[model samples]
Target: MEEDKFIELAKKAKYASKKIATLPVGLKNTALLNIAKNLKENQEKIFEANKRDLEEALPLVESGELKQSVFNRLKLDENKMRDMIQGIIDISNLEDPIGKTLLKRQLDDGLILTKISCPIGVLGIIFEARPDVISQISALAIKSSNAVILKGGKESINTNKEIMRVIQEALDSTRDFPKDVLTQVFSRDDVKNMLSLDKYIDLIIPRGGNNLVRFIKENTKIPVLGHADGICHIFVDESADLEKAKRVVIDAKTQYPSACNAVETLLIHKDFKYTTELLKALEEAGVELIAKPESWHTEYSDKILSYKLVSTLEEAIEHINEYSSGHTESIITEDNKNAKIFMNAVDSAGVYHNVSTRFADGFRYGFGAEVGISTNKTHARGPVGLEGLTIYKYNIEGNGDIVKDYVDGTKSFCHKEG
Candidate 1:
């Protein structure tokens, strides 16, 4: 599409977002349920479209032009379809995040103040291969009363278009639901256009590999909320339980190797007695361990893990803090004090103890689904859910209150919380 055309769509989205912001919770939930129902009824159509995408992607995968992971994500099955539809329903069941009273205070008689949660207006979401992200992000936007413009990977173009069609049809059937609340764009040029439209796009979320995310962040002046790397880590303390360490590390690295929360690096205390056994166990589980200094900062996103020997718990913490992408880190230890210290000092969005890093997910955290994991220090961090898409506004109620009277001390002020 042309740049001007894209901007026009953005303007419509901005207007629609304002309209959605005032929609009652019941209407939003009804729309979500409609989407879910429509998707369930049209599952075979989606599968047929996914089959076409897979057929096109097969040659690219074979020629090494496309990643096998991307291909795998593009090929949706019955299970994925079921999960996607059920995810929308689950989101509709969550508490409405908008219009909640965060703060209420009384400054004086007949003067009250309130801080109420509200939508962040229009969002521009750019993601790769995973067509499921379309449904998840669309559901999140509706539940939170925010508008979204989505750009998906070319590899999943057919599947994305089909899914979006179903979603739009469902919205059309629903009463009082704004169809412009969700929009889809296709083309590399669309991404470029999206980055430049910070005036209409309140937040830009890029969900893909390190290179893609880095490109988006470097080129956009908009407030980009995402992590470029998923260089997560796990450290095994000297007091760690041998069985637990092996179990957790295996799950973290081999459960779903391509996941962002998968552990890419493993730290072991130099004096830990089970180092040799743990390494052997990981190798048996199909994990290739690399112990080079250069591998510390790598996010393998595969069955490859970097290993290191730390002399102390503090050294382990320091290594993780230096090398991790601030995504998620875990410490496996029996010592409570070390666990507390590690959790406090790691400085990652998710710090765990004696558990697999794979637990670092929004749906697992019970937010139903997430837009994406944000490693940013400000605004939303971790798995961004419904609440993350909202900002708050202060509403003050007063009957002809004058600021001059307070400034002149003619009226006494009482600041009290309710």
Candidate 2:
């Protein structure tokens, strides 16, 4: 937990980053597939380790010291295990995001300029409860040819350790794979030390509660790539279908209420005729609806929802743009024009029409998997998969080219791109 030890790990990751940056795509995919196979083989070991974490977390949940939603995320079921392994396989199947030629230019005669995609050097990830993030991030970093150091919450320590062990075992079996491409740190001090080492860690991705993310963003000189809050919303327009409204709202709220993409606020147009019926359907499904104005900014992460009726579609758009955490938002409507207007006007990472906000996911978006979602304007936004983990650099191959010639206008240069 010492800062020196953490710095050592960061340095190793940086070294490993350079080593893995130019690896052939075939080796990366093989390593990823090996990880998936190992996870499938060692799932029982992981489950047993997860059980230990749950045993310790249960008391905290019962005593109200920990939120039940967090405990729910801490426990990994067979479904989650399957999804985790399959996600790794899917990532392996994705086109390698690194080393692709993004742009090519003919600078001049016997001169060429090329821009190619490359890894982001090193990533420092701090997340809570979800031990699956360990495997997902390892696969993504491996595929993207980036090195990563992970810091997980104490609640899932046993699970995280076991998953990382299996993943490392798989990586060790991989031919010529870098050893320190993935590192794990657990301790409050590790976080503090990680934030200070901006020289080594290129990006800090915090995937947890708002307070944890806010703390990291405030204290870190490293550029942070994550949203602090998941205050998502869904607006039901006046011409909305009653059935579609109920279906989308129910799925978005109850499908996996603890998910970051879950809808926390509902905005209904006042002219919508099925208000009473819609509210009744929600209550019958065990949703605790609150109409309080102050709850608009709240992320319940539970079956609780805060809702309000708006006078018009414009009002609904204004409210969402004002209070949404720039995460995901949805509109349930039968009118195509209204849906287009709402979709175009809302400023969020994802905007959907007549669909659940739960669709805001990397795997669901067909990017294989994600390290985390980003609300940042620059760099990665939405689900950060392989593409987001990469940046590009210019590579020019010239034969005795001189800037002085161009500067002095002795020879006019042609800037042509192919």
Candidate 3:
């Protein structure tokens, strides 16, 4: 697809999203239920498409470029499919973010000032081999009243196409949403086209590896919501309870080693009392330890981990500020003051206290499902949920009120609600 075609499609989506923004929440929920039903009915088709992708990806996995977990995420198992449906159903139960009044104030005589949430219009998503993203992000966008354009990695093109087809079938059965509201583009040129459609696309969310994110950021005219890497950190302060720190650190690194929120660096206080015991525990667990001097600023996404010794909280803060991917960072300490200080000082999307960085998720944060883990500081941060998918607008009402009358002394009016 050409850039112009994507821009054209985005234009149509912007118009469609406005209509969806006004759609009743009940109707939207019904559509979500329908989507879940459709996905369940088409289980075999979904897995077959995924299997095709995996069969091809086996070579890539063996080459060491792709992690085994990536392959696992790509395969659509029975449980994962059920989880995807439940995710959609969960989103349906949440209150619609659009059309909710955020603030109300009196601006002038008979003029009602209101700020309310609204759809972001059109959204562009660039992702990796996670085909379930088709259902997940699509569900959130629909609930939030935004149109979405998706671009999956070439390796998962077939899988994405199959998923999109199912989604369209659901939408068709429901007939409550415009088919153009969601689409998948297969070409690299189409992705480039999507990046250039800023006039219609309000935001571009890139969810994948560093190079893909960087490419999207560099090429897009639209503002991107992204984090290039997940160089998460776990700092164990001297005041930390050894048992708590051990549990949290182990869970953070080993829970799902290949995930974005997984801890890649472990920092221990130079005076950390249980250094020997903690080190032995981590080593025994099979974490490939890379010490400082050799472990320059890095984001080891696999089983690899970097170990650093910090003399004080200040040093820990410095190390994180210098090396972290600004994703999730955690500090384990029993002292209240140290925990507060560390939480405030760490420059990360999420700062944890005596907890695993893995807890930095939209679902864990009470959102039904996450669109992505955002490391960006503004617009959206942390786990992006339905609320993150929207923007706000000013809705001002006046009863034959004139700006000139309010400006003039004779007509100086009190700012009060009717």
- Candidates in order have lDDT scores of 0.93, 0.93, 0.84
TM-score of 3: 0.95
Candidate 1's C-alpha runs over 4 A off are none
RMSD of each: 1.1, 1.1, 1.9
lDDT of 1 by residue, 237-343 (tens): 99999999999999999988888999999999998999999999999999998988575788877899989999999999988888889999999999999999999
The regions of model 2 sitting more than 4 angstroms off are none
Please give, for residues 1-418, the per-residue lDDT of candidate 2 as tens digits. 8888888989999999999998999999999999999999999999999999999999999999889999988989999999899999999999988879999999898788999999999999999999999998989999999999999999999999999999999999999988899999999999999999989999999999999999998998999999998889999999999999999999999999999999999999999999999999999988999998575788999999999999999999999999999999999999999999999999999999999999999989998889999988987899999999999999999999999998999877788988
TM-score of each model, in listed order: 0.98, 0.98, 0.95
Q: Taking the tens digit of each residue's C-alpha lDDT, what string does model 3 give over 101-134?
A: 8888787656788989988888889898888888
Q: Candidate 1 overall Cα lDDT vs. reference? A: 0.93
